[model samples]
Target: MTLTFAAPTPDAIPLHVIDQSNCDAWLAGQGEQVSQWANRNGFTGAAGQTVLIPGSEGSVVMALAGFGTADTRARKRFVLAAAAAALPKGTYKITSGLTGRALEIECFGWLMTGHTFDRYRTQSPSTALLVAPAGIDAKRVEVQANAEALIRDLINTPAQDMGPDALQQATEALATEFGATCKTVLGDDLLSENFPMIHAVGRAAEKAPRLIELNWGTSGPKLTLVGKGVCFDTGGLDLKPAAGMLLMKKDMGGSANVLGLARMIMALNLPLQLRVLIPAVENSVAGNAFRPGDILTSRKGLSVEVNNTDAEGRLVLADALTLADEGNPDLIISMATLTGAARVAVGPDLAPFYTDEETHAAALFKAATEVADPVWRLPFHTPYEAMIEPAYADLDNAPSGGFAGSITAALFLRRFVTQTPYMHFDIYGWQPVAASARPKGGVGQGPRALLEALPDMLDL
Candidate 1:
């Protein structure tokens, strides 16, 4: 469910945010009884700790939350959830401290805690509401938080309920909301449309393999975004282990994240010709499944040898990226849960991205640092170009030896995208553990970072 904001009522409780250094001084000003209460409870103001003060009639009068000091790393985003989870059910207002982006993060955190995917079961909606803090843009916080909720919901859904057809429905719904146009090339039509690689990877699935395209905006620079939308990957003939297949439902997280980004852009009315290409498919096993060692031609007309059927994300992405590249837009971004090597390199929290453009690199890092959505840059490494090239075809879907697997995967995709400033993000998409505002489920990797960087990159 979407979390919304409203004006504070008289019954709203005041949430006082404090740090270890300021705890003693602030308690002293509250008089002896309040100071004694804090001392008795041993509330030294550690981060993520909350204390609810009670009134004479057995109702909560005030609440105190610890923001901690600069050394606490995870204390950055969604810190206010501690108070939200601890307090009694009621409306709340921040009485002091926290302004600008910090305040926005706190408010957003409260909403995030309320977002739970109860598709199979029902969850009690959170009555603990947060009134938007002073000097903060309430509408923007609501939009971004709702967008994040949408991403998580899409990612958390089971593959049975979220195949290529379902992804197309989601895309079309988003288009309907923004008055954009959406078209789909499905089933055997993928071959007629010259997207052979996409069809090859998804021909065995129950749902038809398709490409979902969305277009919005009439003026300004052309911006194309491509997302790898492999709805469910059983690894085709190559196959993954039982454990690996467990989380395959989240394989389409790239599409979910980009759609979330698109929602934010359109809601805010960013001036640009926005185009989104999602090659939605499911790699299932059947009599007709594409086999290993098969050579498939891409929309770019470059033949790729499928060394591993499990490496299907790139096969589908190659065709979609080629289509986006044809427009020669100012910038093209491809986000995907493409490789495990990326997780081994930087883990899940820090998303690994590749781009040779110096200006784009600088802007990406700056935006990530500013918003606390971390991303690390991996080199395009021309030396690794030879790794993706096998003797038989123009590219090898899976390189041998697997020594820079992520880099080689990026290189393979880089072949499809020529010039026009391309950026590829090898994202994990799934949050292994819960941290601050981010729950332990499907999460948006680079959307916030890109959102912060795009306006400046486009000179808007």
Candidate 2:
């Protein structure tokens, strides 16, 4: 809600957007004095650069911003982010040509430009404001920004403040906001509720683990979402190196992202019966911590042999996905910051998702392109199914060979959803380096693109 649309005012400053292809023509249109001033200041319309023109009075008149060349690869989305961040703190109106998706990206960028994790800081908030562009939907921009900001705030919090108990509280708050029905199976109750895998993974943490569920909407195709909420991953008894554990606070990014997407869906009142399942737990070290070589029974009646306790996200998710599958929902989507191998495969910018259904995969790919929220489709690759099948149990939490880690992880999860059409996202939720619109911290991925694809996928 921090970003708003208002009627134009006489004092509102003008903002011009131009790229390399049109820079010369734009310069020619400007008066000779203005062109000379811009030249003296070295503003040739390179992306991320900005220059402000001085008014006759001491106050500002207008500003110019760049969007790179028409062929620039970075122009894929959020091209106006740099301008939003670089402009002086004042009311401004985009006065140049920007329309359709491009204009939407501009408005989204403007709202996101104000996001900052100032919880423990003394810095002041952003003062920049924008009057909505002519054809843009300001309400859509506000809702999307709020959802993303919630994800960032939740993930950026330290594990001390974001454990299983806290995660359940966050879910409850969201449910309350939307008037959705909320329920939980906590601690030993998980065992009674047939969520033994979830209990096993989180048994060692001081804060007991729980299953968080929310139901919203009443009359449409059933859609279910499962998220792995590993509140803090200490790699269980296997343990992680200090460097490997640095960003583990964001291990629960799957839950955060699902909540964000849920926010958008509910706010827009999309016609679908929505169900969200999150298994909130912490994989910490203790004498009782589940260890490698242990056999655990899952809710689906399949046994999982723990090849590595660090592979706990899928263990928790197995139980949750089994619950989601029991309903035989029309579609199921599971997201997790599941594997380091996924990061190695696609890097941090692009999320790799696995699906057995070709039509669903095609729709997701097309939606990702349209929204510029990057996701690459990795196959279910039925050939790799054997890799996770150890002789001792129905599945191996971690396979012996190091190759195809992300695919094998997906296969391990695929077993729990036997009937529901399923899609899995292996996401690295932390941004290692900050970009124009993306801050270097916990982030939300895949959901935006998934939301874009839903209407078509559901035939709504």
Candidate 3:
């Protein structure tokens, strides 16, 4: 909990959650001074509105946060975080207007708002402290917060410090944390392991390309996660404009999110056979870089035509997905910040995923709504399979026409997984602006929803 929460004690200030419907009655019960203070300050119980009441001794007596109306609650996911951020540096206990799932959600959201990535530069630590709300699992909240912080730190780091080698190091460290086993097929060893496409996509980078695998949990349903670890996408030979490259430090966000989700699973001791596969690479340009029109054979033995060198994410992920499928896991899920079209399709707020299973889709959608980690299901769209097929090769790395770019990219990755129930996430992986619990920077999408839906999805 660190500075975000203090140990429960009798001296903590009482924090009340008020809504518009009950404001009048609630105010009357508070007596004259508290009621007048709130009314004079224009605190009418609107969402995110906060008013701190003072005592006769001139010290803080209590705190009040408006939960607004049902409509406001529906529109906003982490409404309480705004109020949490406004509170003074004191330990407070939530005393009213939240319980059960509602209390948990609010507490989790508020805890998330406490996260800050202050690696390269120092930032002020979160000062306001909270007593863990009753009826909520405090440890679970801590686990989720720490996992998210790990993702943010990884993605927010510059490419020089967070390249393929750094990603592999992080994986090994996580494995060590959970007593798991890690094995990496590094550099040209990917060639010996039949990961030709991975090598082709990352061979030009100063940091060698590798496939990082971490395994944990020996006694439950098999869940394999594959993430695209393109640490920096210079767009290879095709090249992105300077503006496009500005946020490329977050290009490995898919891998960061997978690691974050893995942390949650491992720390919570979820009943699952967990396997994480990260094909770590940097899409850099050099004389020996794979160029457009090059045909690279993947680990699955599928020859792919490189129509655009910038589409290297799918190239590396292809080999990794093939390796994951070979393990015959119950499910294979791949996450990638793969295309601009995904950002255009759902913007940065909603995570758009593809899954062929109706049962999994229904569970995931329901869990997403419940957890407020919104996700939309885009179809596998089997009819569009032809778009990725090229005459010269079995598949095209980047299909032409640019229509349904995200769908085509998903379909392209799908070609590598043959036996597992597959799900693919085309995530924007960045928050363009700060909103509620979500800060602006490399953000995680789909992972939280997937965590909630896993029991049902794996039939555990």
Candidate 4:
């Protein structure tokens, strides 16, 4: 997490970036001394290749990285991270042209590459600190890194230690750090407090479902966030097959993401009243578990017919959204690892968000571009509303037809949100595989993009 930028000097170790087309020219410009040394040392700029240049004093003087092609600048952002992975353990600073957000992102990339889910065991090759650039905000980089780390830690923990109560504790801890007010309506209290849908979905689990809330900031605009916290979705009575249940530990990704976003907002001290609502529950099967045909009443007073127990994310979100809407917030954004349909539609890396407000959508899209945390917008097609209709309830939790699964899920949640300019993000919080900058584990999606976009959205 430590980043530093220093002035390049001959005495300083060099980091040479090389592509196939530029490698020879770059070496030739260094003149006979360095070029002969490079040639003798068998250095060639092949992708993923690295070589250390020895100086006359037998000291490591320069490190060469291979890019292999001219059009690799798009991938150049990961160069520092790649170097971090390959270099000997120590501190290093950039000696070349890396500035602005690109520098921050490269620093972030290196930090992320160093993340390890070692909750149950030891991790080797600990992260090496990189000296950040001068004049850059070290606190800001720490804020983002800490937030993302919180998400990964929460999501990486096994369900045994990360159940409903544990998740609530995590939020409470966050609230304490930011001087925010924290509260939880637990167990039967959810029903007494009018969170019937949340109670219904969580009643079957031994952990007992509840709503966790945290409020921060003095005031500017009222912005509320709701996240689905299905701790471990066994798919309830409709029971998911073994394969579907394997990664169920990450079902609470929505809640994890919300907390992650909340951390960023509070850390940056964004000028707004921020309220975060997370409905924490373990959607497990039991004799008392709400049946598939059961009609559950939401806090919004809308009746929801349970068509599929596996679609419980929206059910819990409904009550949380209603509670958020009651506060009459200017904006409400909800994130959830809600559907496989979302993955089918947009894949894992890119989350799909639904917002009726065009201006807000544009702001988020612009932010995504600026931050490189991309998200795509899916329409709130009014015509698709019919798919969620039920014979005996205000709406069905899951639509019968399979078309636009992600869209129908959004449409279902929209019924509960009446006034606020709301946006629903269906995010796959788990990275199925690792990349140069992104490791394989829990990821905090959209929050960085949202944070980057917020000042513009609020015209601050």
Top candidate when judged by TM-score against the true structure: 3
TM-scores for all candidates: the values are 0.97, 0.97, 0.97, 0.93
Clashes of each: 0, 0, 0, 6
Best by lDDT: 3
Q: What are the runs in model 2 whose C-alpha is more than 4 Å off?
A: 5-7, 71-77
* Winner of 2 and 4 under lDDT: 2
Q: Over the stretch 1-460, how does candidate 3's per-residue lDDT look in tens digits?
A: 2324569989899999998888989999999999999999999899889899999998888899999899999888888888888777778899998988788778878887678878777775446678998788888777877887788888999998999999999999999999999999999898988999889989999999999999999899999999889999999999999999999998899999999999999999999999999999999999999999999887888899999999999999999999899999999998889889998998888889998889999999998887778899998899999999998999998899989999999999888888899999988888888878778898778777888899999987
Give the per-residue lDDT digits (tens) of candidate 4, residues 355-407.
99888899999888766678999999999988899899999998886899999
Candidate 3's TM-score: 0.97
Task: Select the stronger candidate by lDDT from 2 and 3.
Answer: 3
Give residue 202's lDDT in candidate 4 (0 to 100).
Answer: 94
Those runs of model 3 whose alpha carbons end farther than 4 Å from true positions after fitting are 1-4
* Worst 10 contiguous positions by lDDT, candidate 1: 69-78
Tell me each candidate's RMSD, in Å, in order. Answer: 1.5, 1.5, 1.4, 2.5
Stretches off by above 4 angstroms in model 1 are: 55-59, 74-76
Residue 91 C-alpha lDDT in model 1: 85
Q: Positional deviation of 122 in candidate 2, in angstroms? A: 2.9
Q: Write the per-residue lDDT of candidate 1 for residues 1-460, one digit (tens) a residue.
A: 6678757788888888877678899989987876787788777677777787777777877888887765663535667676677666778889985777777777878887788878988976456788777798788778888888888989999998999999999999999999999999999999999999999999998899999999999998888989989999999999899999999999999999899989988988899999999999999999999998999889999999989999999999999999998998999999999999999999988889999888888999998887667899999999989999998999999999979999999999999988678999999899888777677889988887898899877777
Model 4 ranges with Cα > 4 A deviation: 1-14, 18-21, 37-47, 67-79
